[model samples]
Target: MRVHVHPDRCIGAGLCVMSAPAVFDQNDDSGLVVLLDDSPAGADADHARKIAEHICPSKAIRITGG
Candidate 1:
């Protein structure tokens, strides 16, 4: 699967990063969504996407190509 986050829609809540530290992170200063893996490997992809969708307050993270 391919995951993408719209930076413009991001609120810098840090929820996505908190939900999946291994898959998501934030910019130190800007605190914006930072995708750790655009094309995640194995089962981590689903998990990452799930957490991203759930944690994102703005719902900026989008998962495609399942």
Candidate 2:
């Protein structure tokens, strides 16, 4: 699946990072969401990405072509 995070809408809640560290991260200075892996592979990564997208308070995470 393809995952994307909107930096402008991120609230720095860290839910995405906590859910999927391999796929998501935060900026050190701004603490906004960062896209570590836009196209994550495997079932586990896909599940984690879905969790991160669901838990994002600002809905900053988006998944496409899943």
TM-score of every model versus the real structure: 0.84, 0.89
The positional error of residue 23 in candidate 2, measured at the CA in angstroms, is: 0.4
Least lDDT summed over 10 consecutive residues: which range in candidate 2?
41-50
lDDT of 2: 0.84
Report how far off residue 2 is in candidate 1 (Å): 0.3
Off by over 4 Å in 1: none
lDDT for position 21 in model 2: 86
lDDT of 2 at 48: 58
lDDT of 1: 0.82
Runs with alpha carbons beyond 4 Å of true place in candidate 2: none
Predictions in order: lDDT = 0.82, 0.84
Cα lDDT for residue 40, model 1?
83
RMSD of each: 1.4, 1.3
Tens digits of lDDT, candidate 1, 1-66: 888889899999988887767678889989998888888876677677777677788987888887
Q: Across residues 1-66, which tens digit of lDDT does each residue of candidate 2 receive? A: 788778999999998888888888889999999888888888647665658888899999888885
